[model samples]
Target: MKIYILLVITSFTFGFLEKVVSNPSPRPYKAIFNLGDSLSDTGNFLASGAILFPVIGKPPYGQTFFKRATGRCSDGRLMIDFIAEAYELPYLPPYLALTKDKDIQRGVNFAVAGATALDAKFFIEAGLAKYLWTNNSLSIQLGWFKKLKPSLCTTKQDCDSYFKRSLFLVGEIGGNDYNYAAIAGNITQLQATVPPVVEAITAAINELIAEGARELLVPGNFPIGCSALYLTLFRSENKEDYDDSGCLKTFNGFAEYHNKELKLALETLRKKNPHARILYADYYGAAKRFFHAPGHHGFTNGALRACCGGGGPYNFNISARCGHTGSKACADPSTYANWDGIHLTEAAYRYIAKGLIYGPFSYPPLKISPNKIA
Candidate 1:
């Protein structure tokens, strides 16, 4: 009986091992280094105590995944979080939350809520300070990354070796720069801000490349025209201004312009650095899919309306933002695309991430190779 039992156990163990060997796990990234705004922020906003974007830190924000607000400006995880998961890494700890004793090998998030591509000084100098919320702009976040670099690796060779295995996500930034200008109701200012904003993003990317980053995913801005906030703020009676999807044409065009300039800048960078893999993540096209075909994408609540907001045509009320009094979340966030007036729901982010990872969303698509991102 004992001999028979041993034989059965050995057979079972070998079968399991054979199965595991046949189905190899997907390649994993050593670490991820992320930089951006609220769209990608995991918790830097809450950790740094930047401007009191109270809505993000309160309940109903992370309810779908973390079951509590986690400084992410969403009803759940952002695309960054999903991407990390796909690579089999833990959710990145926000840079602000790190202490000297913490492990630096896993990953870190430099994204902050309300961050912009342009420095706060730019808006302040332009007399648009009121429109600005946080000073943790792209440069500020990149500075934080630089400060943490020494701890990550001391020698030049060590740094190069470590960073080559790591993944760097540059943006989904620069939107707030335009958002603030658009809110100020200055069309000229909004149009004027695009070039500098795209330039700033390109500069940041170049900086990252100089610092040993070999693989970088730089995402462009979302379709602000379809956002609940923009829909509310830029509502127009002129039918021509609104697209068939009910998104404002002018703002979407503006976002496309920024993306176009950014892509061109990336092409230049690719030429300059033949050794590096610099890919453009089309956040605009990925998210816009839902708006173009809401029912087809499982967005039963439609794409323009916010799942959590104060009541309005778009369910967003500036006076009563999500997480504040007089605002509430929908019973089912998966049915909706937009989370608050500005950010997307975890469900929406998941779909977008999948599109980037597996198909027509990203240029040259994001691929998982045998040992790293291809």
Candidate 2:
């Protein structure tokens, strides 16, 4: 009887081991496709001359990165770079500058630094004023991708196959719309603004899906009102209602509402396209944590001040600019959460990327032994 029981146990154990070996969880994504704004711009802005000669592209701005300007909006790497590295993929190359020599098998960045979701009029005016990249809208970007592929692949079917195997990142674009609307005093026109922005994003996703993007990641907006630059110019009388961390509750609430609606829209898209795996990258939540716990990251003081700038109020000037001789420099940029008035430092972005990678946003509910690979 004992021998028979031992034989049965051995059989069960061997069967379990076989099953485990035969089916392992799908590994993390091998490549990343980044689409968005200055947050993930890489060197596109500088390479395109959007940053210009006397601006942030000079010394002090890139003092920490490559010991010279690399066109990144921050002191160092962007969030997308960290995400790509985390997934063991090479740094993403700009979609606009894809060369025949470069290996685009990993992924590409469609994120123009000053890109917007809405029409180009607003950004064009802004670009005219600042000499930045005239808005590369999502629609046009998709069209660019379509045109570039035929040259890379032998046939249309081969191009589609490459897209099918690749991941698509579609976001960090809409903020320019909000920034323009706010500057234009069109917040009350959200009825006119929000829907179109969402539609444009949806259209971009559908276009990518049609091209065979099975895995997609979309990021929502951050709290723009909480930034020191915005607050200095537009601080409400109800500042008392703001939390101890100086984040405006009402602004955060608006952000939450936007994210909630976006989540629902993504879910609907998933239902419509059953084969596509759509995930929302929670930029709002990740940013909030950094603002709340700046010290936990690396920022110690002046969380709202720009690292390279000249000014007293926001540590920024539309005229004095970053990397200038007279510009005020922060003692330590890694400790501060905010880089410019509107963006985050490399350290802050690193923390945010880490949160998105290991947090509920990337893989919700902490799936234990979930069968992702069939």
Candidate 3:
């Protein structure tokens, strides 16, 4: 029966995306600059040598789309990839992989998997030294961008023109800060990190604006309660703790609080930088639709469950994570909302991109100026 359902859902992927790209026309953004964590990471994490023989650089990680691993923490392309496709731009190259001057002319991605909004020093100061895995925080990513700027454009006027034509993606960040806090097993500490995290993101945005960014899309965190890892780690016998969609209410509330604060910060940023278009991408709302109606979205395998991982109710086992031995993948990845336990599948990302591109998901639905489209 499970196999039968999976096959049915696989067929639905083609139909589900028929109208997802209502406006297939391209946008005028000549280049894209992205900053985030695993959700948007194209390849920096793998190229960085952060972990030798990292599981993410193996088979099954990029099996769905690229036909091989590409350092993304999923089965195929991410939301950023779909966004680039919609804009009629090539997939952004990881900054670390740049070898020639022409590499970043189209776009550049500085996002790294497991990156936090706050620096490692902040976590260490907060007594989360044990949780610190990588030092490539948002601040570090900004520094990389700063170093690359001089090479891209020499004069202030040149930079202004170059950046104005580029689209900036600031986040879907700050989640790893919370993730590390969660690993520290301190719910109180986790909640406390919200304010500083938002501030850090705000600071990054301000710096980008100073550097000539005119258009930015800052995304909020997703509903962590609906994630398989959180569901497993925070599982409870208390029925009241779980929401109607089978997600933990407490974790979801945390994500909501973060989103609320982040949105408030973006509101302030818009007021401060009236000249720039600072749009807020409601990743939570875009993703929550799947949990509300999985079947409608062709996620017949359900929303919270992972398409690839070790055995369990959610098909997720931390000890035996996806890309590692003893783990398995679903026959049809397009049928599942999640790919591994942590990241989402290409199908789910397409839906979220659709929401942002043409609908009620973004603050002002992302649209291409008709004249801008060739």
Best by TM-score: 1
Q: Which ten residues in a row have the lowest lDDT in candidate 1?
A: 365-374
Instruction: Give the CA lDDT, 0 to 100, for residue 66 in model 3.
Output: 99
Off by over 4 Å in 2: 1-27, 51-54, 121-133, 151-161, 363-374
Model 1 segments beyond 4 Å from truth? 1-28, 369-374
| Whole-model lDDT per candidate | 0.87, 0.69, 0.88
TM-scores of the models, in the given order?
0.91, 0.82, 0.90
Number of clashing residue pairs, candidate 2: 4
lDDT value, candidate 3, whole model = 0.88
Lowest-scoring 10 consecutive residues by lDDT in candidate 2?
365-374
Question: Which residue pairs does candidate 2 place in steric collision?
Answer: 298-335, 299-335, 299-336, 309-328
lDDT of 2 at 29: 60
lDDT of 1 by residue, 79-99 (tens): 888888878788899999987
Clashing pairs counted in every model: 0, 4, 0
Error of 1 at 5 (Å): 31
344-374, model 2: which lDDT tens digit per residue? 7777787877776667555332112222211
lDDT of 3 by residue, 54-113 (tens): 998998989988999999988999989988987778899999888875567778999999
Best by lDDT: 3
